[model samples]
Target: MSLRTSLTAFPRQALSRPNWRQTVKTSLVNYGDQRCGMAATAHPVTQDSTGSKGPTAMVFLNMGGPSTTQEVGDFLSRLFADGDLIPLGRLQSYLGPLISRRRTPKIEKQYADIGGGSPIRKWSEYQCAEMCKILDKISPESAPHKPYVAFRYANPLTEQMYTQLLDDGFGRGKGGRAVAFTQYPQYSCSTTGSSLNELWKWRNRLEGKRANGGKEGEGAIQWSVIDRWPTHESLVEAFARNIEEQLATYPEERRNDVVLLFSAHSLPMSVINRGDPYAAEVAATVHAVMQRLNFTNPYRLCWQSQVGPSAWLGAQTSDTVQNYVKKGHADLLLIPIAFTSDHIETLYELDKEVIHEANSPGVKRVESLNGNPIFIKGLADIAAAHMRSGQTCSRQMTLRCQGCTSERCLEQKKFFAGPELSSLVR
Candidate 1:
């Protein structure tokens, strides 16, 4: 049977809840306020008199997935409309919507298979809130860290998150510090970069002008970024720990022989050709994890999730798995190297699709770093270090991609990195 026929044959679990959109919308409305109340009560923001930069807003940025099947349409529409991501040019306005509409059903089915929606929102919120709790204890100066999630394509979008930040008195002349901590471990122009650009755009619109018509950034939330941390020691340790735990499940004798396959979402070669740093950064992460494991098992980095017919960075993960299994190397452990938590990619793509197709008992995936204490602690360490450093962004963030020509990229870098480092961009 064709792919479409197979998809249709699968159960439509999501259809059981026709009001999923409303349910999610109502939940989102209460999510921030509820979390804020809990955070304020638990780690009350002390005054600056105590040398505390209290009530620091910690905004987690990511390319969010739809939380429900109903949201898939809008999610894909926004995703396709993003010039930084897809770049359909002048016809984008017309074609983006058209393509998204056509693709929504298939994508919706994927989400349905993964329990009717993406668990990204749930995991992101929990991770950020827990990380903030840790930050309050470790980074007292930036204590009472308020967690916020800003997804590029889903609810609690950048605009909504920023508005909530202002409402909570972080900006709009309050002059509070906020960090745009990208959840993407490795930076990608299409992922973190696009999120930052969208963030910059919203900052300009919402906090651009003061009530007295003062300068653009007068008393706005001072913004900084934790752009990339692919090889951070804590992150490496967390990944290695997960890998070790997964390896423990194998028989003691076969453990060392297992081929570790590190898989990441693929980028179109067009983006790679533009000198995007994502591919390199992902490799760095994989190598770091392997080094932490003392190279006990052989590993190879492969890419997955290529859309359309365009060339993408690969050894595609699925193809690699099939070839390995054919070569009598069925002892394989798949590690999702780039993403922090579970999503459709992990739930449906890796679990339901790839592993199911492979039909090999030896081909298994490592658990996602979702709600892992070590991983959460790593996030806190990264944030605490960034807060202590007083740097607006990483030095690497100041440098544009070798072939980048986007004016938005230039301005966004300038806005966050400030004039001092902005000079380094060309």
Candidate 2:
């Protein structure tokens, strides 16, 4: 069953009518208050003191997907309109909306093939919830670490998440801080850049409102970015461990010969040419995971999810699979190196399309790092490490893009640099 369908299949009781109406009324009131710019003191969502040092919120950012076939067009519209992904210098205002509307049906069909929505959001929520539990236990100093999701081009967009954090009394004072962690395992100017840009724009707007005669109790926010961690120890270990576990499922004698094919989402060749470190970082991640596994097996890193006629990073994954098959390597194991959770890219593209194209009984795919205990611990460790040092963009996690002249790579830190206060406070 589709996730939406399953979720709505619960038995309804007439006895609950009054309670449902009350709940709906309360939500409408809250929504109305927010729309009206009611002062924070009007109806603070949290009971905690706004001026007090608040809980450190770890806000994860990503490109969210449509929840239903109906939303596919809207999702595509937002994505295409983004200048970071598709730079339409002069024609963006007109051409952008045209392209999105034109592509909706085809995209909607794609969603219908894969259970009518992207499961990425659900998996991300699961991962974050699990990570929250781990953070609470291992780092009691940062015990009340709250997890928030900020999507780039969909519902729960950065603005909504910002409003939510404000409502929760998260960003108010000197010690009040939040972590803007990119959920993408490998960094790219397009994915991470687009999301962070939206967030900063929202922050600027809020600050502008405050500066222009807004209420004092409205509160100011401070936040840091967990920009990149392509080679973190725990992350490497998680991938290596999952690879090992998946490999064991194959016949013992055949495991030694199985090719490890790591596939990441492709970006336009233009981005790589302009010195985005994404491709290199992906290679580094694969290398680190391989070192951890200590495997002598043949492996190849390829790119997938190419869109548009523009040149994209090649050794296209589908082409790679066919080439390897022709070379007499039947036993294959596909690992989604870049994606952290099972989303449309993994569930539909790789799991369905690529696997079908390979058309071999020997082909298999390992599970993504969704709600994996070890992986969640790894994420917790990343956040905890940042919270300890009282820095938003840590030197330890930073990578210099080769041939990179673009300011997008390092601009977030300079723009969103927060106060130097320990976010590890409970």
Q: In terms of lDDT, which candidate is strongest?
A: 1
Output the lDDT of residue 64, model 1.
Answer: 89
Ten contiguous residues minimizing lDDT sum, candidate 2: 1-10
lDDT of each: 0.84, 0.73
lDDT of 1 by residue, 1-426 (tens): 222222232233431223433533555456666756743453323334243676688999998899999999999999999977877779989989999999999999999888899989988997898788778777888777889999999998999998888877776677888899999999999999999999998988888753336557678788899999999876786688678878998999999999999999998888999999999999999998988899999999999998777788999999999999999997899999998989988999899988989889999998887766556767887898888888999999998999999898998998889767888876
**Superposed model 2: Cα runs more than 4 Å off:** 1-53, 172-175, 209-219, 396-411, 418-426
Tell me the lDDT of candidate 1. 0.84
Question: Native-vs-model 2 lDDT?
Answer: 0.73
| Number of the top-ranking candidate, with TM-score as the measure | 1
